[model samples]
Target: MASSINHHVMERAEFDRPVKILIVTSPYYKDIADEQVVGAKAEIEAAGGTWDVAEVPGALEIPTAIGIAERMSNFDGYVALGCVIRGETTHYDTVCNDSSRAITLLGLQGLCIGNGILTVENYEQARVRAEVAEQNKGGGAAAAALHLVALARKWGGPRKGVGFKPASDEIQIAGAAKGPNLA
Candidate 1:
């Protein structure tokens, strides 16, 4: 049996805002990550929001990509998607720890970041969650980013001319002109 989180969750307005998410992944795991990306894209599109995809060489690059995405200011959130299975070395620990730390820091700075990367024991475990037809974590991460974007907009204090409208497609913010003025 599963427990419900209804009492602990926020209202729909918490998830109704348009979101912009960035997905960063590892090229070494493309075979696995491809499924994740597919799942994430489907979820993002279906959720009535827009997103952008960025492919990095490896897990080590997720942090930097997030930094660049943050600077864009158009993205309301981010999603870090990757898979790191344990190998003969201790590299798994290093990657997981470092990436988690970097992501956590971004969250602390008020950027909604959804971490969907998998740190598993083997390929078998990773393959199950990365399935394109099933419950892929990539989709889960995208959902998380959307949810947090809702929550962050609520908690991100106040902006004078902010609009809570959901966007139709990927929203790329360029240089801004001010808000509407009325006398």
Candidate 2:
């Protein structure tokens, strides 16, 4: 089983500047969500980073919340936390796939987001994963975001500003010949 297999965990990311991460969680399963936040917060603090929390109704809303925060807030990264335990109907699949997809799309758009939402077969599975002493998937997610932030910092050198460029001191017509200065 996955619980029995050993995995390589990356060391906490190093940052020269303060890292501020926004953690968006869905507390549909309050117990699980709370545990996840604990793990995520611990991981962030361990990396010398600070965090703020935002709650959503469910997994599907977590990504939207992150998107909103990305536009309105100054957080360097985001950690998405939630739990979707399988149900008797297809709602489970919809929640799991859609939420995961949205989070991926946001990441592709250059948003630093770590998806920690658990799509588990049962509460027991979610429990083990959410528990800080167990799988600690929340911490794993935070770690992922931190690494991404570190990479962004490393390669994100001076960026060009947006909007129209300023006019040059001397403006020449498009069809003007450069043979002589007609001033």
User: Tens digit of lDDT per residue, candidate 2, span 24-141?
Assistant: 9999999999999999999999999999999999999999999999999899999999999998999999999999999999999998988899999999999999999999999999
Q: What RMSD does each model have against the real structure?
A: 11.2, 4.2
How many Å off is the CA of 2 in candidate 1? Answer: 13
Candidate with the greatest TM-score versus the true structure: 2
User: On residues 1-183, what C-alpha lDDT tens digit does candidate 1 reach at each position?
Assistant: 112223243232235556667777775788789888888888788777778888898887898899887896578788888898898888889998998899899888887877888888888778887886655778888877877887777767866667786553444232123444454
Each candidate's TM vs. the true structure? 0.75, 0.88
lDDT for residue 83 in candidate 1, whole number 0-100: 90
For candidate 1, the lDDT comes to 0.77
Q: Global lDDT of each model?
A: 0.77, 0.93
